[model samples]
Target chain A: MMEERKTKDFPRSDSASGSSDQVVRTIGLSKSFGEVRAVADLDLSIPRGCVYGLIGPNGSGKTSTIRILNGLIRANAGRAWLLGEEVPVHVNICRIGYMPQEMAIYAELTVLENLELFAGMYSLNKESLAQRADALLDMIDLTERSDSLVSTLSGGMKHRVSLACALVHDPELVFLDEPTVGVDPELRMGFWDHFSDLKRAGKTIVLTTHYMDEAVRCDRVGMMRLGRMIAEDTPRGLMESTGETHLEDVFLHKAREGSA
Target chain B: MNLVRAYAIALKTLRSLKHDRRTAGFLVLMPLFMIAIFGYTFGGDIKDVDVVVVDLDAGSANGSVAALIREDLAGRDVLRIGTSEDRDEGMNAVKDGEAWAAIIFAPEFTVRVEEAIEASRTGSSAAPATVEVHIDASNPNIAQAVVAELQTAVQAVLVGYYGANPAITVSEDRIYGEDAEFIDFFAPGVMGLAAMMITFMLSIISFVRERSTGTLDRLLATPATEGEIVGGYALAFGLVALVQSAVILAAAMLLFQVSIAGNALLVLLTIFLLGIGSQGLGFLLSSIAKNEFQAVQFTPLILFPSILLAGVFWPLEAVPDLLRPVSDFIPLTYAVDACRSVMIRGWDAGEIWPQLVVLAGFAAGTLLLSAYSLKKRG
Candidate 1:
């Protein structure tokens, strides 16, 4: 159910047809909360278009990394680049859609109103805002409950609405934080398919989750533990290197080795 | 700046309040309820105090001073006459808090008066009349009130009996508040109190809730800067404060007949400024509170200072001169002073600019501090 497409023919970036660019790049990026190192000095470079899964256990600094990338929190040292511009200085936040793990959509607002608010934050004009909001609602298959208060929706339905809010502005890069946690198998597969469609449209997608089974759907996966990225490879490559049959056991093998 | 964004946020908040009928009703009726409760309960007039009389003059041979005292006390309703045979009984009554004060007429009171008059015929000036008053001084307000009432009553009686030919007299003429009732004196104070309560309590709790719910973090993650978020909320609550002030002012005018001498719009402006200052203070305080309960615990820290030093309950002049400077820092001091001057003294914005400037300065300072506090490392 996690694998929405059997073709393994994910769309390659048009830039690979002949363009010069790395979508996101960070050098010596570090963040610390006083004495505790949340994200140690690290270097990362992600190409323009890929579904990147960051899999980690709780308190592994996965969320902290995403927050720093989102510019919600500052790093202690080094620099980050989003698209071509440096992070924090030239990154236009409206160009990025971030769905937090906390489901920060207003509970008192209707599903449609939540989307409208996010739309406003992006400075989308009213005429286009309604059209975009409707398209998002229909795409998320929440048109039937669009008028309902988010507080009244089921957890899975609320998650769908949260995703809709993140896409209301049609951002270039999307951050989905545990987007499929409470979703059942069928719905989770549907979300992955939507993300696959977004990746096809040349949007960079980054997600964090603890489910090792879902990591196979990503074009690339980074296994992190204890404020460090333990492994960064394709699912098959990680399994082959660990001599494990399942991605879950491969994660366990890497966690034990500490530097895989 | 960014008035459009501020308007959007304000309209969104107002719509939320509309949907939440309970909070909407609270905003409309809470100030009125506070005003009614405080005005009716703590605003009673200090009048018709009960006093005991020990008359040893035997009702006098002629129309004596003792008779005149009873008649004047009865007329002004200043004293409810209670006669006791022994002075000890009346004094005990006062000590035991039975009566507010006691008037004692000595045994030779009429004899001395007649002899003093006879001696005055030999071209000698007579001494002023003396009456012994035994009072319970534990409550200085009541004690001093009784003394002033007795002095007025005695002067009135002497004037009436002596045909207004007194050698000395004291007269007072009230300029403003000639017929000011308790409600009149309290209406402006109630306005300030309402602004303080709504701005401080609701803003703090609501901001703290946003923090706990993670919505604030999410908001900060957006393109909305710290200034935009705080500014948006200030705009919303500022409009709310205006509507609340208008409601309270109309109610005071209609129900209590509270008159306004200055421009009513200026009163609203004062309340709006007060609300801004108080809301900024609330936001600053919410940064210190980790939760709603902790937020509520800090309310008394603001409330006690405002209540005692802002001259809401009494005149600022009544406060000791040494402690008068402290009232200058209490933001509500400006609110109460400006509102009272507008309603009672018929002062306009020109006359009340000093208070307005102080409140404006307070609002600016607190708002900057509140915004900075939000940026601190947690």
Candidate 2:
């Protein structure tokens, strides 16, 4: 089934030219903290301009893998690449946007100021930063609260502001870690729509979520368990191959088979 | 390494402070309040100790020694004199805490003094005429002041009665602080302490919050380098420390009339270096603390040692010989010493270059270590 899906969608060229089609590629990527292996002997090939979801339960190492890819943390062994450049290097950071699972925006700063800070770190020009901030504020539907302090905003509003900050730099590749965990249902739908829009604009997104329903929205999903990927396939392909109608059932079948 | 990115971090810090009114208030007002409390309340000379006297000596043909002692003590404002008819009453006054000391004169006080004088003139050793002083020794400063004042009174009476003794004479010529009061010596120390404490605390808590809240990870994920983040915080906190020092110095000068004998610019420069050092220290400490609560636990670790050993309250000479060397390792010691030498002794860069060098070394070392720690990934 995996071979059939790969041939149907990816169709490898049997040559080095295949790497250009992928934005992120990892080989035997592993990390350990004390006795716990957060990620172990993992390999991934995520195509460019696709919405990829890493689905897992809590403590399943999704965030650790993303952190290793973003160079926030070092892998214990093996190598990962972003934009064809080895990571844990600084050259490709400017080309990526990262939103951590925690509410990472500065609460003491106003919304506009937070956006401005991230923009400045990316070294965006004044005119371009101003336009980018305005457009992101509109997209996040936070244009009115732009002048309000982040500490004064409600939890949902702060989550949206955090998303706006990640997008402010307009990077080609973005990593959003549970971006819709606490978001309201309406805003969660709005966020998925925005993700689709981002993908249509030729940008790659790598997100981590535990919501099975949300996994179906991704172009491809990697189900993780016990620090290893149990399965990777399209939403329809996973459901059809497992003889299950729901993504959660497919994940359960994959997890059981992985343990067996 | 990029100055523009470092400046962006600094600008963001300033913007955050503008919105965090509570911390901003603490940053500016805490130093001012410290200056006021130290300068006004704890900065006075010990004076006007209460003492009681009982005179039992009868008048003699030569002179009354009790009357001479009384006259000498009355001339000096160091003591407030009260009288009692019985020696027991005077001693009771000291024991009851009503008076710091009690002076009791013997019945043959005048005759004994005259006889001693006669024997001294004949080049013979004589029994000394003594004044019995019962003192409360609980407070060492008050006890010493009482003893010194009484000795001065005795010397004055002997000089008047026996003429000036040519055997030995002592003169005082001070190199610094000739007429300076305690507050003048204290203001500079407070400036250094305030700069160190405020800058260190602000940076520690700020960085800890950034780390625990995951903003540090987000920033790290950006193009900003570790050095840029550390440099940015150092620049911002350095400015805040300078402002705090200036406010404290201005308040000290205008309110307490504390003197600044040297170039005011040098004093500020010393404080600025101290601020940078403290900021670097804050960053280094932040790497150890996992949360704001843990960060705050470090306050006493910094406060007690600095206050006791940094010559903030007392000079290094007053600290025990064994503990004195500990002050040399604390960064605040050099800052306080440099500021005092600059503001009180009017010392220039040439005179204080060693202190400035140590402070610069501390700032550079801590900042480099802090930046390296930030770059380390777990």
Candidate 3:
């Protein structure tokens, strides 16, 4: 389904061959900033149409991986491919959407204007942009206040606008770095439901989260520690292997296993 | 580079300014107010200095030599003549700061002048009448003006009244700026300074804010190259500086009656080049600044030096020889020198190409360095 959408929506160079593989892949990906190793010999493989969550503590390199994959930064040593196009492919930015951890939208611009700007970057026509902006506004539950400046909105409301802006152009792959950090529980539920909708539409989502409950909802979870992914599996697979009932306990079990 | 994409970024920046009216007002009005306030307050020649005159000269029937000098002083607008009975009183007025200067004519004024004139005809030495000047020297420029005014009045009285051609006469010829006022010289420097402030500070502060707010991160996620980003903001800021310089120049010429010896368009072109170069320097400087506060701290570091060393308020000729090398290295110096030459000295582009070339080279080099910095960050 992700392959179908990759051809239908993005039309990548290799999509003509109809290659169905991991939408994101990394081999021996390592990035260091001075003395701190942000990502060390890290490996990542995310299939199309899968809602993959990276669960890690602070300084565990979840954001670094997303930044590296988005071509916003370079890895010290690594190879990464996105949609069969090697990483740092500037032209393929249109095929992927990145929602950074910060409130990256312009505070002075209205919520609708923010979505329109990102959509315009992808060359979405005015008519389609209006339609998608409306739908995304509805999904974010900000339809009525779409004309309000992002600065006037509360912290949670700005988070919602950030999510809407990320999905505005309907990119085939999405990288969301802690989208629901400051969001209220009710809105967080709405966000998870929207992710499910995106997955059903053959869109791949790779996100980082601190919520164990949200991690349980991912199709697969990669538990990272000290810039290394100690465990990668479905929530049930990790639970069954560690004999742990809670995702948090399963992460603890993996952390213990890796340290030992 | 895709200019259309770069233009989109520029439009977004402009729209941000349009939405925030207060910031937009500051950006446009700050330079205008700076130029106008400085222009109106420090615009022109000094006038109406108070001077006490004590006349003790004994007239010898021909005329009172002291009276003739006093009348000449009273006729001029530069000095306000006040009478004093004694020389001590006149000196006291200057000492107490109530008057700028005191001019005292001694008791032998008319006799000494006649003897001096007779002695000059016979080619014999005799002392002429002396006018003692007691001046408040706290302000040297004011003191100089008072002395200069007195020289003109006394010289005229001596030549016209006494008919004594004792020595050499000096004549003057001006090749440029025949009727230039102090405002004419100052307006060009203000324009260059305005351009530098508006483009450089805004670019640096705005870039730092964007980086901290994650807008640069968002921009990098797009296909826009580093050069496109720099070029986009440069275009917007360059146009802004052009408008600002034009407004300042027009107001200066219309209100202050400052005239340009050369083309007005050339002045703006000079400002635009300096402005874009300043924007590029802003970008390069932003790399060292971690946030908007830190970015703001860089302003005085750059502005104070430029204002002082760039020959903005004073002529380069007035700058000490030790600082001339520093002045030559500042980009604003070139812009100011170019604008002044065009406006005051009436130099053409052909004559001013060295300055223009330096300005162009600065803009190109800083802009390329900025683009390289952005590319490196990504």
What TM-score against the true fold does each predicted structure earn? 0.72, 0.74, 0.73
| Best of the two (1, 2) by TM-score | 2
Which candidate tops DockQ? 2
The DockQ values of the predictions, listed in order, are: 0.32, 0.61, 0.41
Give the per-residue lDDT of model 1 (tens digit) for B1-378: 899999999999999778766556656765675565345434444554677887776535675766776677777654567889788887777644467567777776655555545555556766544567876433344456667776777667656765432322222222344455667667788788888878889889988987887678767767777777887777777778888989989999999998887788998899998888888888988877777866876676677657766778755434444445777878888898788777865778877898899989888888888777666533
Best of the candidates, TM-score: 2
Fnat for each predicted structure, in order: 0.48, 0.91, 0.66
Error of 3 at A16 (Å): 17
What is the per-residue lDDT of model 3 for residues A1-260, given as tens digits with 9 covering 90 to 100? 01111212233445421255678877678888899999888777889999999998988999999998888888877677888777786656788988999989999899988988788777899899989988888888899999999999999899989888888888899999998887899888888999999999999999999888878999999999899999999989989999999999998888988999
Q: Is candidate 1 or candidate 2 better by lDDT?
A: 2
Candidate 3 runs further than 4 Å off: A1-18, B1-166
- Predicted complex 3: CAPRI docking category: acceptable
Colliding pairs, model 1 = none
RMSD of candidate 3 to the truth, in angstroms, is: 15.3
